[model samples]
Target chain A: MIRFLSILFILVSNTIFSILEIEILKGSDNLSKVAFVPFGNESGIEENYGSQISKNIEKNMLLFGEFENLAVNEMLSYPSSENDFYYRDWKVLGVDYSVIGKVNSVNALGNLNISYSLFNINRRIKILEGEIVGSEDNIEDISKIISNRIYEQITGLRGIFDTKLAYVINSDADTYQMCISDIDGKNEQILFTSKAPIMSPDWSPDRKKIAYVSFENGLAEIFIQDLQSGERDSIQALGMTNSAPVWSPDGKSLALVVSFSGNPDIFLYSIRNKRLVRLTNHYGIDTEPSWSPDSKKIIFTSDRSGSPQLYEISTKSKRKKRLTRDGNYNARGRYFPDGKSIFFVHGNNGNFQIAIKKLSSRYIETLTSTSLDESPTISPNGNIIIYATKDGSNGYLGGITLDGKARFSLPVKNGSVREPAWSPLLN
Target chain B: MNKVLTSLNTFFLILLFLSLIFSMFSFPKLNIDETQSIKVNFYELIQQNDILFDPPAANTLIKKEAKKTSAINEKTNADETSIISKFKINKLDIKNEITKIKLSKEREDILRVSAIIQQRISSIWIKPNSLSESLIAKVLINLAPSGEILNFSLIEPSSNTSFNESILTAMNKMTFFEEVLSLERKLFEKNFRNFNLVFKSSGEIE
Candidate 1:
C-alpha cells in the first residue's frame, strides 16, 4: 500500500506541475550586446563610483530598449583599461561591445577625473575614448553624457535620456495634480494642484515653461507657468471652453482650441504680442491643435466632416485639408518626429486605441492592441510612444516602441494617471 | 533414467554445434568487384557533371568512351585516316579531362560545405523575440579550417537587434564543426574560409 500510494502521488504531482516549454521568438535584430565593466577607483574614495556609473548607464540603456547589456554577474573579467582587456575574454562571452573606465583624483579642489573607453569586441578595435573632470556631485550628469555618446555612436540618433515628462494624475473627483518627472518616471515633482481638473499639459520649445488647461476658477482657462520661477499667467476664454494648447517649434506662439465664437475653433496665441488669432471657424467641434514641425501648419481634430477626424490647416494660407479618412473617430493627432507621420487616438467598434498615420503615403498603422488607449505622445527621438491605457479598473501609463516591438507599463500606486506629454530633449 | 537424459542432452548439443559451423560457411560475401564498378561509374558521372542528367545519357557517354578506347587498342597499325581520327579523339579526351578536373570537384565541394553549414547553423539557431518572418539579417563569419569561428560581423543588420544577436549567439554556441575538418584544404580556402549567411526565422536556405 505504501508503494502504491507513493506512485500515485508522484504521478499526480508530475501531471499537475508539468514543465512548460515557452517558445522564444526573435528579439530586436539591430541591438548590439554591450557590457559595462565597473570602472576602477584609484581615487581611493569610499563611494563606489565605478559601480554607480556603470549601473546608471545600464539603466539608461535598458530604458532606451535598444541595446542589450550584459549582466555584471555574467562578466568573467572586469577590465578597466586597455592593458587589462583580453579580446578573447569578451569575445568568448558574446559581448559585441564593451565600455571600460577608470576614476582618479585630479587635484586638491576635490575634482576627480574619469577616463573611459568603448571597444568593439567583435572587431577587436577601440571605437571611442574620452576623459572628463568634475566634482562628485556631477558624476550622475557625467554618466548620462557618456550614455548619450554611446547611444549616438551605436544608433546614429541623439539620445533623449536627459528629457522630462509631464503628466496629470487624478487622485479624486476634487483633487488633481500636474506632475513633472524624468523620462524614466523618476524624480517626480508636483508642479501644480487644483480642486478642479487640470488637463492637456504641454511644454514649450525652450523647456522653460509649461502651458496647460486649468479649471481652478470653475471655468476652463489656459495658464502658462514658468518652471523656474513658480509664476503663472492665464488667458480667459470668456465663458467658453479653452484647452489643448500646443507650442510651435520656434517657441514664438501657441496654437490652442477656444470655443469663444459659440463653437470650438483653433486659435493661435502669440507670446510676443499677447494677442489671439483665430485660425478656424468651423461649426463642428475643433480642438486638440498640434503644430507641424516646420511651424507652418497646424493639425486639429474637427467633427465638421460628420464624425471627428484629423484635419490640417496652413498657418499662412488658412486652407484646410482632411488628414484621416479611414476611421470614424480619430482625434488628438500629433506630428511624429519626422513630421511625415502623425500619432493619434483611434476609436472603432467601441474600442479606443493609439494609431499612427503617414501623411505622404496615407498609410495608417495601429500601434496599440489594448482598448481605451489614449494620450499618445511620441518621444523626442520618435522611437517610442507613451500613452494612457486602462487595465481592468485601473488606468496607467504604457509605452511602446514605434515598431510595436517592446512594451512596458507604468502604473500609479493608487491614483489614475492620464494626459502624458513627453517633453523635448533637454540639455 | 539419468543415463537416458544425459544421452539426449549430448545429442542436442551436437546438433547446435553442427548448425553453427554450417551457418558460418554459408554466410554470403559482398561482391567487391561490383561495388568497385559502381564507384567508378559514380565518379565518371560526377566528372562529366552529368549526375543530375538522365541516366541514359551517362550510360551513352560511358559506352562511347569505352568504344573509343577499344578501337585505339585494336587498331594500332591502322591507315592514315584512322590514325588522324585517333589523334583527334585523344585531344578531345584530354580537354574533357582538364575541364572535369577543374570544375566538377570544386562545385561538389562547395555544395557539400554549404549543406553542412546550413544544417549546423539551423540546428543551433534560436530566434529572438518580436521579430517578423520577413526580417532577415546577413552575417559574415570568418572561420579556421577546422571550423572554429574566428569572428562574426553583421554585414547587413536587421532593424531588430535581438534577431541579429540571436544569430550571433547561435554561431558562437557552435565553436567548431568537426565535419569541416574533412574537407580538402583547397576547397576550404576557396569557399568555407569566409562566408556570408542570411538568417531568417523561417529556416529556409536560398
Candidate 2:
C-alpha cells in the first residue's frame, strides 16, 4: 500500500506541474529573427528580475508568431548597454535584432528600475530605449510594457501584449468557472465560480467589466461583473432565456439575445437609460451579436432563411441585410479591426471550421482546416485570431494568422477550455 | 554605198569561181577510164547551169560580225564574274547580321540571374504579419563586379516599418551572389550593376 501510494503521488505531482504549453504547428518563413540577452543584474537581489523580464518578453513576442527568438545559449555575447554591444557579433550570428537591459535597485524600500534598449543589428542603430521604475511585484507588467513599445516601433501596429483574455473552463459536468488571464494564459484568476454551467464570456470595451451568462438561477441569465471589485449586475430577463451579450465598441450599450418573445431575437440594451429595444423580430433564432468597429452596425447570426447565416443590422435605421450566402451554416461572425472583413464559423457537410469573408465582396477564405472549430476572436492588431477547437475528446484553444501561415495550439490540462474572448487592448 | 556593195559582190563571186576550178582539177589526174567521161559530162552540165555562190565580201562581213559577237560575249562574262563577287559579299554581310541577331536573342542569362535572386530572397524572407497582400516595397540594390552587395536602399517605403525591415533583412542575407561573376563585365555593368527590385508577399520580383 505504501509503494502504490507513493507512485500515485508522483503521478499526481507530475500532472500538476505540467501546465498548458503552446505548440507551434506551423511557422512563417518570413519571420524576423530577434535575440534577447540575459539582463545584467547586481547580486543580493532575491529574484532574477532581469531574467524574468527577458523571458516574459520572449514569450509575449512568440505569441504573435511573427518573430523568431534566439535562445539564451545561442547568444554569443551578453550586452546590457551600448558600450558592450558589438554589431558584428550579432550579425555573425545571423540576428536581425537584439534586445538588452539592466536591472538595479532604486531604493531601500524595495523599488527597482530597469533600463532596456532595442537595436537594429543590420543598420547598427538603436531603435528604442526606455526605462521603467516600479515595485518588484509589477515586474511582469513592466516587461509587457517594454514588449508593447518594441512591437509598435517595429511592426507599426499597436501591440496586444498588455491585453487580457476571458474564457470559461468547464471543471466538470455541473461545475464551470469564468476565468481571466494574461494574453499568454498566465497569471490566471477565477472571476466567478458556479455549480451551473457558464457560457459566452465577453469583455467590456473599457476592460473594467465583463458580461457573461451564468446559470446559477436555474436558467440562462446575463450578468455584468466588475473585474476588480467583483460586483455583479444582471439584466432583467423576466423568467426568459438571456445569453450571448456583446458590448458595444463605445461601452454605452450591449447587444444581447433574449427569448422573451417565444423566439430568440437580438435586443439592444442601453446601459445609461436601462432601456431595451428589440432589433430583430424574426421567428427563427438570432444570437451571437458582434458590434462593428464603428459601433454603427451589429452583425449577428440568424436562421430565418432556413439555415444559420450572418446578417448585419444598423443600430439607428434598424435596416437588415444578409451577409453570408455561400454556406448552409454560418454563425458567430465578428468584424475584423478594419471592419472591411469578418471572421465567422462556417459549416460544410458535417465539418465546421473558421472562415473569413470580405464585407464588400463574395470572397470567403476558410482559415482552419480542422473540424469543429468555432468562436473565432480576432486580435486587436487584426493580424492573429484565437478560436476554440477540439482535439480527440478534449477542447483546446488554437491561434492562427489571417494569412494562415502560422498556427499554434494551447491545450489546458485536466479540463476543457472554450468560449475564448480576447479583450481589447487596455489603455 | 551601192557601188561598194556591187564591188564586194563581184569579189566574192570571183573567189567562189576560182575555188570551184581548183576543186575540179584536184578531183583526178586523168586516171579515169570510159566511166570518167560520164563524170566530166555531169560536172560540165553543172557549170553550164551556172550555180551562183556567195561573194567573198559577204563572207568577210559575216566573219567580222562573228568576231565582234565573241568579243561582246567575253566582255559580258567579265561583268557576270564581278556581279557574282558582289552577290557573294552581300551574302557574307547578311550572314554577319544574322549572327548579331542570334547573339542578342541568347539573353537567357538575365532571366537566370533574376531567378537566382528570387529563389535566394524567398528562402530567407519572412513576411511581416501586419502587411497586406496589396502592399509592395520597391528596393534598390547596387552590386560590384564580384557579386558583392555594395549598398541597399528602399526607393519607396511602404510606411510599414516591419515590412521594410524584412525586405532589408532579406537583401542583407544575400551578401554575395556568385552567379554575377560569370556575366561579361559590360553586360553586368549595363544591367545588373544598379537596379530596382519590387518586393511582394507573393514571392514575385518586378
Q: Pick the candidate with the highest lDDT.
A: 2
The candidate scoring highest on TM-score is 2
Q: Which stretches of candidate 1 lie over 4 Å from their true place?
A: A1-31, A236-239, A411-414, B1-206
lDDT of 2 at A308: 93
Lowest summed lDDT window (length 10), candidate 1 chain B: B77-86
lDDT of 1 by residue, B1-206 (tens): 99999999999999999999986665433233543544454455346443333545644555556566767534432423343443444445456657777778777766776776677666556454322234678877777988888877778887766566566666656667556687788767756677678776532110
Candidate 1, residues A1-427, lDDT tens digits: the string is: 9999999999999755542121222333345679989888885576678778778888887784666788888999999989999878888887878999988664677677888898867556787888888877777778888888877655555777888889998888788999898887778889899999999999998888999999898777899999999788996544377788899998988898888656888999888887888999968999999998988889999999999999999999999999999879999999977676788989999899888777765667788899999888988877778999887866799988765546778646357888999898875
Q: Tens digits of per-residue lDDT for model 2 on B1-206? A: 99999999999999999999976664433232564534454444335433212334433554556566888656655544444443444445456556656566536666677667767766776666644334667777788999998987888777567778867766666788778888888767756787667765531110
Worst 10 residues of 2 chain B by lDDT: B49-58
Cα lDDT tens digits for candidate 2, A254-357 = 89998875688999888888788999888888999999999999999999999999999998899999999987999999998878788899999989999888
Local distance difference test values of all predictions, in order:
0.76, 0.79
lDDT of 1: 0.76
Q: Weakest 10 consecutive residues, lDDT, candidate 2 chain A?
A: A18-27
